[model samples]
Target chain A: MTHTDNGFSATRRLILQGASAVVLVGLGNLPFGLAPAFAAANDKYPEEAFKAKSEADAIKALYGKTPEASDKVKMDAPEIAENGAVVPVSVTTTLPDVTSISFLVAENPVALVASYKIPAGTMPSVANRIKMAKTSNVIVVVEAGGKLYSATKEVKVTVGGCGG
Target chain B: MASTIRVRATSSGETTEVQALIQHPMDSGFVKDAKGEIIPPHFIQQLTFEYDGKPVFTADWGGGVSKDPYVKFAFKGGKKGDELKVSWTDNKGASDTTTAKIQ
Candidate 1:
């Protein structure tokens, strides 16, 4: 029993030392750990796309061109969002070659709420729950025939979701 | 490790509707924690839906989304027993994936 007691203390001390070493290593790599996370998040997409303050600018930054209002695209949203945090919005199009669909909440801090890439043979329709900072126009941009088209609808919200 | 996602997909009338509920804090980095410290940004940035091997629907999300994000979207072509894979990557470099079969 006496011999085993010494071994137990030795093992406990070793574990404590190992934990301290791990903590020191983690502190040493703090800068590297945090930098890659931010780089990865921003590197996946253009920084300007999300920072665009207006719907038009977001569309341009996202698609590299302005969109024209077209009747072929259908934008659907509630006349009033009961909950601004989860406003259901959808876009459908009858146009051929619908490549992508994007949603923008003009009143939010960041205008571009969502951008969807629709592959061929898949439906040209998408539904998503987006946050509306306030009462604003919900814009849907669709890319078809190598051109950009858009549709807009106003959604009134009583509660602001963007940090409100 | 990131949180889990529950996915369900059903096909009807030549269309498949996919719905997924992702468990996440969705910290906007604007909210403060118990100690008044700003919770660093940790939210799913992108989510992708794939059928078989092709990408059908993808979403670029931000931290403004509510907690425990729920998303639903539909696509044109899908059949019963077809596999639908949903994957997501967060700002913290954590990722999660789950799959369901069209019913």
Candidate 2:
């Protein structure tokens, strides 16, 4: 009886400790919780975008509208990426009120790789290291004033980033 | 735990360039472990860069990004000795922040 009681108390203590940790994390009580409510209203990550198999479908799911190629969107990527695992991709736009920016890899299993929200007054430029399964046309989309614009650049990958 | 986010900022001309590397597995659920079991997806979901408490850059990342992801960006109005703070939150609800002085 005593052994069973001790085990039960230990389990209860663990449960309490777990609950407190979660509460502290959620409340941003830790030093790393600077912006506790960073995206409370818009933290809804698009589940459909990352699961999309085709570029068009991913763009459709993300913006609910088709994107048109625009000269205002500038995408800078290597003509050939020596390493597919860390292809440097950057996008800049002259468009105003830029709301969102996304990168799509044509040949990856899933087209949408990364998407970012550009808050007001911040620059509409972003750079990230993205993985490509193979040589593919990288598409960048920028949303501004409720309209979608895009630019594409073909990057040749010598090595496959996704497992062979 | 010590902050795993490493940040460096340098000023050139009128813009301040910031580069950061975050230590993370960035496991994609599609990958299998050595035991052939699927590794659950865990990645940094959001990363924010602040200059003196004002947000200058923010990113929404997914698992497709490589492990120990690196990001580079620049803002127009940064000066020397200014504090550049970076904070990130992973899908598991864990967060970390680190600060660097602009050079």
Candidate 2 lDDT over residue span A44-107, tens digit each: 6677787898999999988899999999999999999988878989999999999888999988
Per-residue alpha-carbon lDDT of candidate 2 for residues B1-103, written as tens digits (9 for 90 to 100): 8789999999885888888999998875666778888888898888888887777777777777888998877777788998998999988998899899999
TM-score of chain B of each: 0.93, 0.95
Interface RMSD of each: 2.1, 2.1
- Which pairs of residues collide in model 1? none
Candidate 2 i-RMS: 2.1
Instruction: Identify the candidate with maximal DockQ.
Output: 2
Clashing pairs in 2: none
Worst 10 residues of 2 chain A by lDDT: A33-42
Docking class of 1: acceptable
Error of 2 at A110 (Å): 2.4
TM-score between model 2 and native = 0.76
Worst 10 residues of 1 chain B by lDDT: B25-34
